[model samples]
Target: MRFNRSSCDKCLDVCPVKAIWIDDQGLHIDRDACTGCMLCNSICPADGLSIQNFNFQSVLAKLKDLQSPVLSCHVVADNQAHIKIPCLGLLSETHLAVMSILAEAPVQLNLTACKKCVNGVVVNKLQKSLFAVAAKLMNGSAPKIKLIEEKADLHFRPISYTRRGFFDALRHMDFPETIGYSGGLPAGDKPKAYADKAVPDKIKMLNKILPMLPETLKNWVYENYYYHLRVDSNCDLCLSCVMICPTGALKIGGDGSTGKIVFSSAFCNGCNLCAEFCSKNSIDIIKGFSGKNPSAYASCEAAT
Candidate 1:
């Protein structure tokens, strides 16, 4: 998450409305000011600060019913999409990739009305997320995407609802008590203490999606998403990585003698905390790891 306390303010940086910030009390969001453009959700490496949480099971169920699944932002969708989201900017590469895999067809994105919207920033973010999905595609072919950018497209914004109502219903929804703290409260209201316990949504999605990779593409997909950790004989068994890891991906296991590290690829969110905290420098992430620092991967091993 925060490699350093001052590092990794991605959600704060990407917000078009400048709705997010952090102070002594903790992170805060100007709820009323937040347009719910959702750029913050797809960009946060820690998977923190998602104002719109989707039920993927329901998404999948709907996806199966529509042979020609069309996805669009609420502004332009107007009953046109099988999946209508507040903004395409909120979608991560995992979302695009999963939908593509499930549909077994190009996932259509309606972008014809994007330039007309004040939230034009989402177009760029959506492009970048699509690019990320494309890179992991083993064939190095174009991503499974069909962009509906023609001006004549039938799926245009409707005038029934004003822009102000895009996410007005958020306050009335029955969600967790802490959900309201993400945004929509007065400036004086601070969020509850950071619940650093939940495994981010992206991590869960990655775990499930990897297993669905076709046999031929599976190895290449693993190289793109997972890492292998190596440990040298010099390890002190300090287990600092285990302590610092936000996800319990790394552990040490043994019967009676000669303990060795165990890594669960499913839980690793690619935070690379274990690589940074290793005092021995014995941890080396061999491949498939990318971070702010090229050198800080893991013990004699690769990062997952």
Candidate 2:
């Protein structure tokens, strides 16, 4: 979920409005300046920039009622039965993959007006990348989703929240009692803290979606969705990889006298940070995910 050492600036690169920025503490959104276009949310690999109101859960729930779901941004004219989002750029691979697995009919993304939109270029790229990854996961199986330019004519209706709904929301507010220092630390730190405490959203979504896929696709996803690490004979058991792993997928420990390194496939996002930091070139990343748990004991001399 978190890549502390990651120099990935995909979100920053995609924002057409320059409303998002990263500092020492991490990614920050200038909400007043942001139009809620959701370009950053779509491209963020860490699942970091989500709009509170338009989340995957809500989208999924909406899909349950429609046989053919069309997702469109506000700029587009509403279709008869489409689920409208703030921006098509908000839909990530996880969202598309999950929709494909759960929806009975093909999912259509209405991008009829994207070319004229200010965020068109990034939106186009995001959709293409998500489509490519989804197709790869399906092993060339016909994708049950599509991106197309088709306009529909319909009016938008605003949802009115009831008094009880408003009151319930008030009960769930997470407001701090007092304002403190605005910003100083890097935004990566928050994600790092979260990674230390919970599984990344991608992994969690993959686990849920895998079971629903066909057997071949399921196996393929399990095999290709993760990055596998191998320790060779050259490994000096320095345990540097363990310490460098951002997701805590790789861990090191000892029985006081003996040291060992263990890897949990569940946690690895395949960022290659561990392999990158290994000084001995001792770690090799297999392209596919491993079915077996990964563990290795340090050579006795290295443990000493």
Alpha-carbon local distance difference test for all models: 0.61, 0.60
RMSD of each candidate? 7.7, 7.2
TM-score versus the correct structure, for each prediction: 0.71, 0.67
Cα error, candidate 1, residue 297 (Å): 18
Q: Which residue segments of model 1 deviate by more than 4 Å? A: 1-6, 23-26, 51-53, 75-79, 154-197, 232-235, 255-257, 277-304
Would you give me the overall lDDT of model 2? 0.60
The residue-level lDDT of candidate 1 at 225 comes to 59
Q: Model 2: per-residue lDDT, tens digit, 190-254?
A: 24443343445656667666655777766666665665667766777787777766566777756
Candidate with top lDDT is 1
- Cα lDDT tens digits, model 1, 183-264, are 2322342333322445667666655665566755656555665666677777788877766667666767764477667666
Minimum summed lDDT over a 10-residue window in model 1 is located at 290-299
Candidate achieving the largest TM-score: 1
> Given candidate 2, what's the lDDT at residue 260?
62
**Count of backbone clashes, every candidate in sequence:** 20, 9
